[model samples]
Target: MSKRLLARVAALTTGAALAAGAVVAVASPALAAPLGTVNLSQTSGLVTDSPMFASAVTSAPCPTGFGEESALRIGPAETGPFTNLTPSLGGGGYDKAPVTANPNRSFQLALGSAPANGRWWVVVECFSLLEGRHPDRFVTEIVVAGNQWRVPVVEATTTSLAVSPASPVEAGTPVTLTATVAPSGAAGTVEFLRGTNSLGTAAVSGGTATLTTSTIPAGSWSLTARFTPADPGSFGASTSAAASLVVNGPAGGVSKVETITADVDPGAFTLDVAQPPAVELLGGQVGGTATGALKQATITDLRGTNAGWDVTGQLTDFTGAGNIPAGNLTWTPSAAKASGSGAVSAGTPANLGDTRTLCSSAAGSSAGTFTCDAGLSLSIPDSVPPGAYTATLTLTLV
Candidate 1:
């Protein structure tokens, strides 16, 4: 990004330099022979290759901030008829002068309409460097034609977009969605939609688009406006991608936290602990009164809508009073509050029933009713020994 100055000039063969503050005067014969036909030739400036979106050096900055750089010059081509000249700036064919800041320093020309994303060049005055002569003011001869090239866009581009937990989703749970756009301009907006209902819109700088739903009502939805052009006529048209999202269930409604179970080996029994259940630990006597243990649970996926779902669970040590109970002691209920941070396809937590639990048991008997000192609490059970246990909990998300 250099500084620039543009000066417009015309030839006045016999014009004399002006005095300190007086205007210069041109000498002309009152009745000189009729002038010859004034012919104009088509000419172009110099061309250079540069990266896409890269700025071109127009005029060099002045050393002491003294001299100025003028705008592009109009001239005839080498072998064409001479014609009138018109000044254009910024490559838009707009009749405007080149802007400048420092008098004799460098300046830049903005490269526009360059399709690709790479190198370009700037047209500058032609000057000669020789010994002893400063060229007075670095006088340059302007060449016509050859002044435009392409530069890099310095941005990202995407071919399409995708939504998690595909359409027809349940309400309440969060549904995470993402979009892809190509040639992501400097900056723009990506809009989300539910059949034109504008779920919401997000700002994308590079080439990514993200949107989250607040447990939308069960129905179909779509994503749009993945990409936009920097300026109209930019590349001639606009581009975008699309995706679908469906939501199910009621709006703003709450139901009892569902329970989970597991299907495993007959002897090894699989305890389903998807989401935490109302009764984390359940145990009854196969003979002598059976007792419960430290109980706690963290509920989730009440209705199957959490796009990103996860939970944590833990149970305390179990103690046997004596010996008398039979029927191969079994822990009826499992802990369902244990889970790690995780992600689901695409669907709101409110609309998905995704949860887990943990459970442990030991055979014993011979004593008063089995009593668990530490009752059900959110905290991990302390009576449970340190050991890892995995269980499966089945839940309904309707």
Candidate 2:
């Protein structure tokens, strides 16, 4: 072979060798660029009761022509092979599903079980294309809870309750009760309780609940307001300080007088006459024929009056044919009886066309109530026509 031809062959071999070396260098794995700056939803004040969130934004895309996987792990500060709290991302692996050219990524880590009560850290690992079975990237570590993350020890919130018409309300009067909850942004309802009995439940608006009722008994009452949080894990239940309410009994006074009038029914009466052989006749007696009930009056004078009060009644004679004398009918009033207060006296008897005092109560006496029970008696004379007789009776109070 010629010497020039041999030199040309050697040059071609060197060129081929250099090209193979370049290809090998391109395929080999190298340290990956940073995924980006990781930002936690909450860094220092995280608690085990709520979910954790994280996000990362990259200005530059993932290494071209290579797939990347993102993952999040939480464990004790000095532990290796930390627990994969978000295994659902990568099918039970600490790595998330692979993606190409991810510029921005976010993760929501809801730990299936609460971690041990201690300090913990969150590690975000972004892996480049795998070489065989191993990731070719480093992890970014963040101290989420230096010492603050643990099972939450919730503290109760203060509450205040108030009642309208504060106290000493007259019986049968309606009252309004209101409760104000602290952390006014809390969302839920409030239940009002009287002693141990539940009055009702009211939805909270602007952190306040109110109830109005008129059925509360006349006595001292203890009222309380209980708050039920919509999310118990986020906030604790709270109860208001006990409130006092007093209701008073009704006032004392005289009631309006009521009047009742009744008619009389007189049956046949036997008559007796003095004559030869002393004849005894049927339906001939002058009197013992008329029957009647008294006109009634009821008065309630609960206020012990300094001066006495009197009840009087007046009667008018009948005006039918063969007029019977006004004096023939007599009216008698029975003793008045009082309930709960004051005494009463019997009334005087009077003929028709005259007024008679029915009852009287003395000063400072326990006789505040009065009722009338007047009776009437009729007298018929011989030779009187057989007819019905009626009279009007009027009762007055002073």
Candidate 3:
């Protein structure tokens, strides 16, 4: 071995050792820093009537010497530049340190006030293991999550009305009008109106509002209830269906008669004759005679001299068996009398088809009482079925 050979061999061995070290370093994997990710509790499609809440969670524990940083922001749908909210993370401010017991940091955001009705988005950003006064470097590693929230407006309430002494009430009589609002929890006032004329206003209590009035005139009137919401912005107003009211004039002299009235009594009959049993035929003919006693109509006339009165009667056909023929029934007024200085005229025999005058008085008359008596004869055909029969008799006086 020579000196030149020894030097060359030493240099070559050193170079080979350096090359092997470089290859080993290139095969080794690089080191990665701790990363953070945010997961929102509500991703989207959240509807709220009042306040809402959301939570953000991190993927891993915060880095050493750095606390968790979080913020909440909200904006209209499809819009940018969201507005940040002051959130209470882990029951404290954003700058507060996270609890060590829970490795995955969790923060809660409360939306105390709801925005206007429509679509909106809630965005949350959480930075884990952040440090320094100016933490721009940590911001790039921040985790963000967003969700769509909806705050719908309250629906309008419904209203209903009821009027006492429904119809044909005497004028000057006290009448009560009640208005009820649906959704019992509704708070508002109701205005009573009579065909666009304000009657009065009443506050709703226990879902009902009432108003009393005695000044309604004598005529047909339509009453309505209009509701006014206390918070127009929150709840809408509504109106109720109209209620009909009919008022009558006071009882007094119209022209000459101070007062005139009449009373009518219905006629009844029971066909139970042993000798001739009544049998209804299919042709609408009666086998035996079925006679009904006469009905009475009494009239009280209070008038001066030269006063006259007339009475007319209208009869309805038997309703059984699809309306029994009207001509089958006939009416006759047998007895008629007048208590005053007027003669009472008897009524002619007439069928139930047309109007018939049953009684009349002379032109000259005074305060007196009049009485009328009538009888009914029924002729049922064979065609009429066997069933109960009914008819109505109407009496009018003038």
Candidate 4:
């Protein structure tokens, strides 16, 4: 070979050999990259200063084949004593001592009992004894605690009173009123009132109360009740609407005509005018009757457009549950007659009941609660008990 060619060849060979050596050195170190770090985390509801929790340590890694002298460094300062460190789960392989560090390795710590209130902390650390290695840093620290929860609730109730027929009459008609209180289980008392007068009172037993009144005049009246609280502030109070009473007049055509005296209190009125007695109905249901003298009675028609009169009534059973009603008896007198005279119209229902009274304002006016007077006969529904049943009619004039 020539000298020049031999020099070039030698240079080329040295350069290739150097490149190959450098490649091999880099590859060897890359194969075993040093671990970046070891991390630890924990969670629990248990209080501190107690035995460690078994399930508190969620993730922990321990180096494999660790020597007896090797130790783990956990926490910020790594100053806590490393005693009682163990796997708490029963029959767990990581329970006993001789714990070794392994990738994806975990240990269930045996936490002491929980404190009254607070939490527990568990930290996992790792140390290395490898030659020329730096001091072991914290691998990881896990914090865990228990959960606290509760359920909230709200309660409510209402009180109400249902009066039969709503409208009332006089002449001692029987009237029934019911008071209902809600919330199922509550203790309280209920009071009954007629206008501003106290009628009676009852104690609530199982959230219900009932009352009746008799001897109520033939004028409009109101019934009201209030419930007393059982626990002062524990529960709320309740009230019921007023029950109405109506008083009816004597039969028509027996003229001992009486005048509706003024002073009939002024709120509402419910009155019943008796059917004209001994009158004939030439071709109607009340035809064929005429043996007695025609009678006349005077009533203060407070409901008349003039002289300040507006009255209303309802035809219903004592229970107050039945078909809707439609009937009203009104009168308009010439001039401002305090007491007017009117002939009783015949054909009223035998068992007729009614009520009338004066009201201070138009809002309290009631009418249309009258029955057809056909005869002197009285009747009751077939469902009515065989025994004699009495009802109260009420009225309020103010």
Off by over 4 Å in 1: 1-159, 184-186, 231-241, 251-398
All candidates: TM-score? 0.26, 0.30, 0.31, 0.25
Worst 10 residues of 3 by lDDT: 14-23
For residues 1-398, could you state the per-residue lDDT of candidate 1 as single tens digits?
21111111111000001011112121211211111111112112223332212222333332111123223221222221211122322222111222221111111222222122222222222211211111111112222223432222233344466777766666777877676656655356666666566777777656677887775765565555535545322322233555665667686755565789986532211122212222322222122111222222223332222232222222222222222111112221222222323222211101011221221221221111111111211112324332222222222121
Backbone clash count, each prediction separately = 118, 10, 14, 94
Clashing residue pairs, candidate 2?
270-285, 271-284, 271-285, 286-380, 341-368, 342-366, 342-367, 342-368, 343-366, 343-367
lDDT of each: 0.30, 0.49, 0.51, 0.33
- By TM-score, the best candidate is 3
Better of 2 and 3 by lDDT: 3
Candidate 3, residues 106-221: lDDT per residue as tens digits?
22233334445444444443343311211211111111233334233466899999999778799999999999998777788999999999999999898899999999888889
Candidate 4 per-residue C-alpha lDDT over 1-398 given as tens digits, one digit per residue, 9 for 90 to 100: 10000000121010000000001000110111112233222232223322323322223232221121333322222344333343322222331243343212222232233212222223333322321121222233333324321111223557788776456353556776678887757677778777877767777778888778764555556667787767543467777665555556444623354677666444323333333321211110111111111111123443543233332222222222221111111111111123233221221111224442222222333222222211111122334222212222222233
- Candidate 3, after superposition: displacement of residue 159 in Å? 1.2
Q: Estimate the lDDT of model 2.
A: 0.49
List all candidate RMSDs to the true structure: 36.6, 49.4, 42.9, 43.6
Q: If both were scored by lDDT, which would come out higher, candidate 2 or candidate 4? A: 2
For residue 104, model 4's alpha carbon misses the true position, in angstroms, by 42
lDDT comparison, 3 vs 4, better candidate? 3
Candidate 2 segments exceeding 4 Å error: 1-156, 252-398
Residue runs of model 3 more than 4 Å from their true location after superposition? 1-152, 253-398
* Model 1: per-residue Cα lDDT at residue 395: 27
